[model samples]
Target: MGRETYTGDVAFEVRGHLGMITLNRPKALNALTQLMCESILIQLQDWAEDPTVAQVLIRGAGDRGLCSGGDISSVYRDMLEHQPRDGGGLLPESTPSYAAAMPAEEFFAVEYRMNLTIAEYPKPYIALMDGVVLGGGVGVSAHGSHRVVTERSRVGMPETTIGFSPDVGGTYLLPRSPGNTGLHLGLSGIHLTAADAIFTGLADTFVPSEALEELTQQLTEHPVDEVLPRYAKHPGDSAVEQDAEWIDAAYSAGTVEEILVELEQHSSSYPGAQQAAAALRAKSPTMLKVALEAIRRGAQLSLSGALAQEYTIAIHALRSHDFREGIRAQVIDKDRTPRWNPGQPETVDEDLVAHYFTPVPGKLLSLE
Candidate 1:
């Protein structure tokens, strides 16, 4: 019908009865910020009530990716602003209690709410998950009714590598992945190709990257059901599906240490097994345990429950030493080496892991 446009880091347009959103920061891989999350949430709410908008389609502005993740560098800076300036103690007890609210709190609250909105959208919500879709990107895209992946799509929840567990409802989505593949991806922060994403139930249709523009044009002129079939193609067999046997066997172990032991003892035929073990060993030991527990607990909880639990974990993690250190190594310093608090998975106590699951005093995520 009528064409309209809204600008900023997140741009919005209405084109021929289609609601279009583009994450516009190509240089940073369209990394989401607090304002971006709020913009998306408000637009989704408005569109949900609008009669003219038949459907919604979201994609990135450039060829780099849909989104890298949340603007974690901002979150890191915010945490610094609110915490002790003398590089506060690394222990959980010595961390800031968040006596007053912080931007990080509002950021995640808005983001998780945005995720829930996408999940419950009334119209056909389509996400062109073309390239890098990790963390917050996955939250925005994976919950949509129509998740379109391409040959270039690379998906994962790489939270553990940052000394954090998966948030953005990742615990709910990844835990339901085929067999224990979710556990492997969560703990290792490994990227997934198109076929592997479909195999794990994270993506729906496969559309070639080159054909996306034409497909969007078709969508504007016709309904999705009529337009999708012409462009959607099978992604073919998934390597993750084939490796499920060893993946499941190793990740199914009771604890992270046991899982590592299982991986180390696996036959040479499964080269991936050893690689996974190495990946896990490199991540923050406490977070690895916390993430594994979160996934296991998430399997028994609903999406809302998992989101609530993840919120609690996020609050605690923000105050953690490893989270900051991990960010410094990976993002700021580019050192690629983080000296974890416990330094070893076996040293992470069950009590410390359990501590993360408790409710945050005044900051509970109210999904109801």
Candidate 2:
């Protein structure tokens, strides 16, 4: 097979029969930008049509992380300029209309399309996930045919922390998780190690972090169907069982507030549960409610239906106050103190949660 190059900030390299797509911005922990997403989609399309490319291997450049999330810092700056300051106030005279247009429905349309493409790609796709895999990273990795995790792999749907419901097929996958693990993780913004990921069905296989290079080499040399048997080893008992007691107790609650209250009440008995509770307590209350609702509703939906449902929620979330404020605190200002809408989970009404999933006129996600 001949090697070819695809140009972008993302490092696209083809060697042997496999094309490796590496998210290359190590300084930002490989946070994905719109350009990176487009570039990847283009490359995947090209490779999908090419006969020589036997498989696709997606990974990150450095050892620090896979990808932290989307480049929300840029999106947040744009949101501040376009939307009203408090109520319905107009943007300042100096604000650029281009910046204000960023949270455009088009972005979500393109991003969700990319995710759906990955999910339905003709060729085998393998994601070598090591280190942080959150938010948009989950979109890229989890959609693959084979998802490889390492001891260093830390996975989560941390969108609620930033006042966003889980997007990019999260509605589909999270609801598929056993028991209420998906609902629990989505609302709590918890991180799971490789072992935890495997137990929870988030990762297809586990490889030692030290063995990643060898695994990559094997993938480059062999077909993906054979790569696992050639180099992969059996994983140990998953870490999901470690938190079984706490997860069952807290996650079984009917509402987000009830879950939090349960966590707070049980924190003294389990240190891990205490940490998880603290993290959930710190996230956006509105996002938590929406995420919980999304998972609950998504559980009853087909894969495509869940994606369509998530499309509505995602578009509405962009126009909501909490999404921008959460991004400002977490990504832009780096203050780590989001002034969440409703301020408390208990204050968020069920109607507001339902509003997120309500369809917008002519805004349906076209899977075709």
Candidate 3:
């Protein structure tokens, strides 16, 4: 089959009837931009019906990361320059619209739809997940028909760290995590190893980093339906199984505060859990609480339902005081100190948190 490069930034090739798209921004560790998201979405649609393209493989260019995340630094800069900074301290204003008169809202709308499309793709889709799969990265890879990871894979739903409740279908996937494991990961932004990824049901297979090229070759040579069984002969239990005790104990807490207390108390006994709790403590407490609620609610909804719910929370979060502040502190100012409202988890009230879940007018997600 022929090969083509879209915009030259992303490499698209068809080898052995498998359409492969590689995120090419290795310098930025393949951090996704709006352009990249749009390109990939369009390509997926084009190839989905191509009779010659029997399977699709999505991967990163370099070894650093599969895709780091959305271009947050750009998003923060845009928010500060154009939009009116809502001073009422309830929700922040929406992001400035792009030239097509489409705001960040449309960006998210299309991005989420792309995510669902990958999840439900008619043809087999494989994600070669290596390092630093966060936020937007998770949206693309986690929902694939087959997600393959290496020991270097560092996966997470880390939206809380940036003052956003997990977007890009994180709300849906995080809650679906076994038991409360989803809740814990969503709130804390903890990174998971390859084993952890498979254990949590986020990845389908684990292979050593050295075996990646060989595996890619195999996928190219074989039919999509035959690849999994051929690769299933590897060793090692899933990541979750290795950390079962700690995950179950630390995540079982009823509330975010309770989870922190338990983690602090058990830090000496479980270093990983303790470190995770400490990390959560460092993030915006309000964001953490919202993330928890999002995950819990998302777990119960269908994929389309979850995306619709997340759209409301996302638009509301855009107008939140903590979001802009979080972006300022974390990305723009690089101050590393955010003046969060309800700075502590206990200070946030149920009604205040409820505002984020309020539905937007005519904001239904299209999952076609």
Tell me, by lDDT, which candidate is best.
1
Q: What is the C-alpha lDDT of each candidate?
A: 0.88, 0.79, 0.78
Q: Tell me the number of clashing residue pairs for each predicted model.
A: 1, 0, 6
Clashing pairs in 2: none
- Indicate the TM-score of model 1: 0.96
Give per-residue CA lDDT, model 3, range 38-62, as digits (tens).
8888888899889888899988997
> Could you report the Cα RMSD, in angstroms, for every candidate shown?
1.7, 3.5, 3.0
Model 3, residue 218: C-alpha shift (Å): 2.9
The clash number for model 3 is: 6
TM-scores of the models, in the order given: 0.96, 0.91, 0.90
Pairwise TM-score winner, candidates 1 and 2: 1
lDDT of 3: 0.78
Compared with the true structure, what per-residue lDDT tens digits does model 1 show for residues 287-355?
Answer: 999999999999999888889999998888877777887887888788999888888987877788888
For residues 1-368, could you state the per-residue lDDT of candidate 2 as single tens digits?
Answer: 53658655698888888898988998998988878887888889999998888899988878887888788887776666667657321222244432344454666666777888898899999998899999888888998999998878889888988888888789888878777677777877788888778777778888787888888888888987777866566767665667777788888998877887888888899876788788888887777877888888888887677788888887676667888888888877889987776887778777787777777666678977
lDDT for 297 in candidate 1 is 93
